[model samples]
Target: MIPLSPEILAALALALLAGLVAGAWPARRRLLAQAAEAARQAERAAQLQDRVAQLERDLSAQADALESWRARAQDGRLELAQLQAAHHEKLAAFEELRQAFDQSRATLRAEFQHLAGQVLEEKSQGFSRSSQDALGSLLRPFREQIESFQRRVNEIHDASVSGQARLDTEIRRVLETGLKMSDEAQSLAMALKGDKKATGNWGEVLLERSLQLAGLIAGDHYQAQASFRDEAGNRRQPDFIVRLPDGKHLIIDSKVSLVDYDRAVSAATPEAREAALVAHVRAVRQHIDDLARKDYSSLTGMKSPGFVLMYLPIEPAYIEAMRRDRELFDHGYRHNVVLVSHTTLMPVLRTVATLWMLARSNEQARALGDQAGGLYRQVEMVAARLQKLGHALGAAAAHYNGTVTAVAGQRGLYGKVGRFAELSAKAGRPLPALEPLLADFEVQRLDGIAPGADHVPETGRADAGSPPGAVPEDLHPPGEPNP
Candidate 1:
């Protein structure tokens, strides 16, 4: 509002010019900085573009490689599938071939076994027949027993071969039957739970069957329900009395009750079963005690072992009893009682049968021994007679030889008989030619004769032409011609 002089105005103009120059310098510096920043941004953008192009190229190459691998993988998969199919077919063929081989092998084995059995049987029969024939005259005393023994041997051999062949089948059948029987037995046990007499009868039947299976005859090898009277006149009847080769007895009694065992079998719970088992064991123990009191070993006229056999009809009952009471066997043994099931008793019966066979064999051998001794004595008598006959024959031969030497010597009857033949030339038989033996002739003597025993000196001369060593004419047979 109060502008005064030109100098003041000039000063204001210089200040304004300096301010505009400062502003223009700042603007130029800002513009140059902005241009450098824009250049760096563009360079950065170019580097980014180059990296994107390289990444695109790499992606395309990888796609081509992946396609090549995929094609090879497809071919490999096809080849693998074909190989698997061939392997499976070959494996199936091998299985069929193996099965056929097994069938052929089995057929061959059966045929071989059959042929072998037949051959063995034929040979055995032939040998037995021949032995019977050879020994028939010599073994007159044992003929019947020998025949019986031979028949038994044949029966045993046949049974053995048949049993061996059927053993596998029998074992399988037994296992299957045992399983089935176990179920049936459980049911039977339930039915007979309260019937004491029925259970005893059942046990006795099984015991008899076992004896029969072991080749024991009822009247011979064993007796059923054999009654013996004790000292007190008590009629003690044992279910079976098995006879041994040594004339001893095996007493088997079938009196065990299976009622508690049946209860155990039908128990509804673990605790119930446990209780029933305990009761069953106690019942078995009680039965053992009762059987032990029978004292079958002390029966009159019977040679029995100390222990009596207590037979159980069911195998499972025996097994369960023993399983529950591990010391049950020792317990029964201490009480002179033996617990036996069918399976266990079979071996004892078989052993008894074997013993009987061995005893029969020993008896046959003893008879043979006695016969052999008699035969040896007969041979000695025959040999002595043969020696005496040889001595007589040797003496007769020496006498005949001496008489022949006397006649056939240079001074024998032939020399004088030649003149007689000339004298009787007209006789019908032209005098049978009498050729003397060679002067160096030899006479064979009996091998066993003593040196001088068979020699005989000529007693007297038959004719004047006879030699001094000639035997007497009376010693020669009347009908015999001169030597």
Candidate 2:
């Protein structure tokens, strides 16, 4: 037991209080550390949950991609099956056609052999030694004629080279201007982004001229420079709406892609060329995207299908760029844009016009054939009537000749040439009467038709049917009257 003095009791109680306080402080600190550890564990649990959620999301995306791949594989298998079936059907049909062709060929061969045998047997007697010699003589002369014809053909070919070159130069000159203007038209379209009357008029004129150069008329063949509204209420005006011969419309967006090409051509170094080429490729890709978004799918009134005809106003360089970098062009086709070069468009336009012309020509030929049939009938009737006409003509000619001779002997027409003719007769047998007619009859050189073509346009009658400004003296025979 402890002493119970006032001071010592107080001291002992104080010491006990100190010891208790110290123990309680250690217990409180341990409890606080445990609470902090629990908080750390809770945070780690939250992080693990987040990581699990992320992995699940990744797994879902992969599954979706796998499902898409399976769908594509199924579609491919179906296409392959259909292709195999079509191929088998085509092969069977081809075999049937082959059999039919064989039968027809055999029949033709049999008929030919039968005919040949019959002709050989029946004509065997007629084709004796004398006849064979005559045939040889005739064939020899025919070979000479064929040689002459071939020589004339060669001369004609040699003469035509100049004309072909001239025509090519003329055509290229005319078309080059249009190509230059097409470039300007592209510039004009870009300039049209700014609101201006000049831009508007320029756009219209550019489109109109392009249509005309493409051998089209606006009212008849196309509708030029039509405007459409975008979602932003801004007006979009395309350059050309080429109406094909079948009255179908193709929207043409002319883009100028030659700037980068020009730079590349003028580049002073390989590095420069490479830079310019890369820039040009990007520009072309951008152009494809721009031309693709021309509301072609919606405006053309087709969904999931549309043709965007991009008109590059340059030469084959633009087309070559696409060929060199196929990825850029693929960007275009992904959007259903077809990049058309000047050469391709020119032939396409020409073909379209030629087809139209052919259609008209066919119609004209049918009509002309009908008219020609009627003309043939009329000509046959005229041939009968011409017999009577010939009799009258002969009578009139004789009368005229007699009258001319009498009048000439009256010392009026023959007085001028009488002295000269009498002197010529004393010179050489009176210089035959036909010599004067032969001197005036000029055989026109058909130089315009290359060669081998005696296209003597109306040269038979020297007096009535000679070319303009032909010689007048002795155009008719000396016995024939000019009247």
Candidate 3:
């Protein structure tokens, strides 16, 4: 309850002052530190705001660039689609062209073959007619000679029939003339018999006449006096070497021995005639043996058959030889010698001529086939060129379509340009209009290409009236007369 001492009061005032001073200093320091922290925080907030603004601008620029890229991508897609469509169209056109070319080649080949066959047939017919005319001319003289001989015989017979004395003298004169003619004939026969060259020539003339009637030519179907060398280097000449279409040669030899035949006919007695006939048979057998020994089949450069032909010039002589010795024919066959007369030889020669004609026809056909092969090769070359052209066209179309698709697709060049303009406008900076891209192109289709329109004429169609697979009548040769 007592009043405070003066020293205590003074001490308390000082302590109070000290405490107030100390408290003020701490508050002021705390307030200054808070102020400094607030200043640093405000500076950091300002920097963060600036950084956020920069990020916003960068994000906006990135968005614009992305839009532009997207537009370019759309353009690429559009170009690709267009290219695909163009490629498809080009491929279709190429296929059509190839088909047309093939059809045209085939049609041309058929026409060529048909024309060739017609031409060959015409030539064959003309040749045949000419040959027949020549053969007829050759036989006319022989026919006239026979008619004259018959008329002479009839006149002689008429003279003999008259019974008056004057007519008897006329008959005797006719008889003497007949005897002179007979003697002349005997002399000619004897000359032919004596001269080997004349005998061979006579036989050859007969053979030639027979062959002509048989439609065979000397050099074309048969060679006269054709010489060949044997394996032993011995050269021999055959009277006639008949050529076969199958590359075979028929050797023919004509040797007529009329001496024995004339002796037999003019023999004084039956025993002499028999001996003469026997001698004639022996001569014929010897000739056959000689022909066999020639071995014509072994001749070089000649495809001679195993048998040789023993041609008898006269039909009467052939008959007499056969009748006198029946075994002569068999012996000739055994010796590989076939005895043939003018009548028999005609048939053989005609066969050979027919074979030659057939061979000629075959050769013509082979030539035609070769021509066709050449034509086919040419067609193939043309086709290859067409194929290459088509391939190039198809590739071009594909590239063009791709370009169109790229230009028209979303995010393509046009799209990117539009987007950029829009972005510029939004930013209050409009861009100028870009140049317009090319409009989509429409490919035109190929037309007017058809098969066989280039080489073959349109009028070359087969006859409507003709039956299926019917050949033209001109393809066949004219009918020839039978030998």
Candidate 4:
């Protein structure tokens, strides 16, 4: 080969370098793509692992729930078994009771059939000669008794008939009298309706009667036609003034007009009645307003309530007024006027009376409490004095015991006697034997004195034949004294 030129060699080297660079780029790109694929596959595997873990956790929770449900089901099965067993036992008992009842019923039926057959046989046999005679003897008294009962029943029937006739006559008379009384009452009502003063008087009378029925006396509980001056110096006379326990007065006015109410009641046509009813309602409202304007609380020397009562003598008039005006009661209340009938006022008066009674009882109780307190103090003082007396008695008993012990000592009277005797013997002149005196002056102890021991000589006093404070001859140690 000829010697290669430098340019040719350089061109060949460049071609080789270009071809190597191109091949390396393809290999690097393939490696990068492989790495990216491997990363994606790893990420997918990690997500699948998380999903598997979540599924396992869910399965675990489901298994735990299934276990719990199984436990509950087992418990339910046990309870159902117990209930079924109890039901079986009850069924067995019921069957046994049914068999027993059937047996008893069959036995009763057989016995009844036998008895019925015997009765039929006896009935078919009819009465024998002796049985018939005996039966006739037995039935004779019954027959006589039945005859006497029949006679008594006939007498009672006759008497009842007469009495019924008399009762019917009396009933007719009573009916006639009732009708007459009703007519008279209607006439009186009409008369009352025509006269305003009379109507007021009637209402006052009814109020007084109601108060009396409620255990309230006229002068003691209430006053009639009591006049008082209002705040505007207007002299108003209420039908009645009831006194309460608190010194408060309830003013009651009974001069309400009833003419429209009477007209409403007697009206023939509905329109006329409605008109009269309206008029009645208007009259009542006017009366309520008038009474409210009176200002009864301003009465001098009397603690009157803010409200006044508008008294309606008749119950029918009151009912009609209320029926005509549905809001009449509310309206009256607003105006401080209370409308009341005889029937309604009775309870109010009774309540007032009860309040008074309670107040009186309270006063009595207070007085009794004060007296009891004083009595308790006196009792305490008495108890104190008794305690002091007991102490003084105890001290006296102690001093008496000490004196008794000193006087009854061994070296006391007996020792003195013995010394005196010795001195007498030394002087050649023995004193009369004092032993006899010592014997007569023996000491005795008593446990306690009997209740009626005044006749017995006291231990501190001289006996009939002994010295002072000496025991008697009949007295013995640890024994009862001779009577």
What is candidate 4's lDDT per residue for 105-147, written digit by digit as tens?
3443354344334433433244367854664464354345434
Residues 413-481, model 3: lDDT tens digits:
656665676556465654344333332221111111212225321222222353221222222123411
Candidate 1 lDDT score relative to the true structure: 0.60
Whole-model lDDT values for every prediction: 0.60, 0.50, 0.56, 0.57
Report clash pairs, candidate 4: none
Question: Judged by lDDT against the true structure, how good is candidate 4?
Answer: 0.57
Q: How far does residue 297 in candidate 4 sit from its true spot (Å)?
A: 2.0
Q: Model 1, residue 264: what's the lDDT?
A: 77
Query: 106-225, model 2: which lDDT tens digit per residue?
Result: 443354344334433542344567854754463354345334433533443343344334434533543456446645644544444534455445535544554565556667666666
In TM-score terms, candidate 3 sits at 0.46
> In candidate 1, what are the lDDT values of residues 1-483, reduced to their tens digit?
896799998999999999999889989999999999999999999988977875796577457545643554464345435534643553344343333333433443354344334433432343455644653453343334334433543444454445434433433343234335445555677888669999888778767866775668899999999888988998999889999887889989887888888887788865677788799899999988888777889988989887899987776677778777989999999999999865556546655765675465455444433433333233233233334544454465567667765666578766666677667757556534434222221112212111232332222212335432122232223343222
Q: How many clashes (backbone atoms < 3 Å, residues ≥3 apart in a chain or on different chains) does model 3 have?
A: 21
Ranking according to TM-score, highest score first = 1, 4, 3, 2
RMSD of 2: 23.1
| Deviation of model 1 at 321, angstroms | 1.6
RMSD of each predicted structure = 31.3, 23.1, 63.4, 41.8
Evaluated against the true structure, the overall lDDT of model 3 is 0.56
